[model samples]
Target: MKTINFTQMKDGTKEEYDFLAEMEKPYLSLTVDRVLTELKNQGEDSLSGYKITRLEHGLQSATRAYRDGADIDWVVGTLLHDVGDGLAPQNHDRFSAEVIRPFVRQEVAWVVEHHGIFQMYFYGHHYGWDKNAREEFKDHPCYQSCADFCERWDQSSFDPEYDFETLDFFTPMVRDVFSRKAYDPKVIKENQVFGLPEPIFHKLS
Candidate 1:
């Protein structure tokens, strides 16, 4: 299996860890911490009646895609793609888009936006494919981007939001809405992860 590692920084001193060699994977420290903060607030179950937490779903979705043979970067993007949902529906996609834009290729950011397929269907499409959705979506720069990205989506598994209260995945990951927490200053340092470009948090604060 492929191996991953990390090096902690302490006052300009770096300490490295061979995670795979040590039987660990440390790629998602601060990245995941931020994602978890969002999950902690999602508070729901999946559409299949299974306990699919939003936070967990994002993590699991990434895992599912990976198991299905996606690359490492896609895995990370899928996992934290919806990190913005923890903020607000409209705002989250933009926030996540920015966060992932610099680090990944535009495609990754597109995936992050389309994770909210409902948003795409409603705002971007016209009951048809992207060609039909383009005009409406073109109204907003980000929404237009989502249209192109969503064109190649996997639609076999249906996601119904109407039953969200009863649908686990639609349910929030956390029971109560978490107070909008201030993001860490360190996030700025991640601006160049090669997936997400700008500070996705721009939509939040």
Candidate 2:
């Protein structure tokens, strides 16, 4: 493939920028494959010594959400809610939230972002933290939703014998979600309510 010749962004022609944007689409597609590979790799170990691998826990969470008639965003969010553990264990929820924020509803992203604190309601006491630590954000609109996510999907997902579906079963959904534009103008506009730059809409369009 012919590459742009300009060493500096200010020297690039419109044609070069256009070519780069078009090339980005294929690279975006590759990101989905890479994410899937990473998810599979996460199965090699149990989280915090849990019996099931993180992959199985993810599958179990997604399976439960699927059986409960959750939407694609919800199921996919459950599957990836902890995919950042390997790279961002101390603040995995934030990294995971950003990964799916572009592809999912804001509500789903909020649940993923705050699931760690919500999860503490179940076991934080073991680490000398308040079990009700999540209460600190009781006034947030998505508080109940995140609470439900931890209660029904995340905290309960460590079952080793559950008939959870395989990662293959959710592969198509993963591809479909990531295939969407990473920054839809409409979504960006809505996200402005949360402090994302309004100028991003023009930049994307």
Candidate 3:
């Protein structure tokens, strides 16, 4: 069956739905490729006025996570945390979270989803917004995790001079991540809060 025979979802037959699901497998298998392409596009076009490109920022974040001995999920999550900015600037954090939710741990997704609010602690006061806005999530299991993510990886990644890894260096890691079984309970580890690894300090010359 090349296509479904129904004009509307309400009229689709079981056989047709099954066929569609089977057809989706090939597209699903290439998810990592699409993600990588989008990340490269971010290097070409992203929000202006930053010291580095959006792709550079993500690479720096992931480089930091990997150098700190974070697991693959943490490193990839940091790499793609801002991916949705090009298409969903208004709430890119949540959008980016959804992009990785099926593959990474729940704790990582939670941090990505809420990092926007948590990040306000750095510059919101300059605009008269409540810098403490993230305090509302203080009772949640991943609150501190999100706070630490913003402080270490997200907010601190804008320096153009930082020696970040190239996209090629992280492509294999990205493939390893998105290739996982989607939403596997063992992979998600719901509500688990293995917070960010301690920074790996490098002495200045």
Q: Which candidate is the best by lDDT?
A: 3
User: Against the correct fold, how does model 1 do in TM-score?
Assistant: 0.42
On lDDT, the stronger of 2 and 3 is 3
Query: Residue-wise lDDT of candidate 1 within 46-153, one digit each (tens)?
Result: 224534555555555443444445544455565556667656656776677666555554455555765565344544446554534334444454553344323322
* Model 2 weakest lDDT span, ten residues long: 196-205
Please write out the lDDT profile of model 3 over residues 1-205, one tens digit for every residue: 7878899999999999899999999999998898899899999998899889999999999988888889999999999999998889999999999999999999999999999999999999999999999999999999989998988888999988888889999999999999999999999998778898888886433
Could you tell me how far off, in angstroms, the CA of residue 11 lies in candidate 2 after the best superposition?
3.8
Model 3 poorest ten-residue lDDT run: 196-205
Q: What total of clashing residue pairs does each candidate reach?
A: 28, 0, 0
Structural RMSD, model 1: 14.7
Best by TM-score: 3
Question: What number of backbone clashes does candidate 2 have, counting pairs of residues 3 or more apart or in separate chains?
Answer: 0
Model 2's lDDT to the true fold?
Answer: 0.82
TM-score of model 3 (CA atoms): 0.97
In model 1, where is the ten-residue run with the lowest total lDDT?
A: 196-205
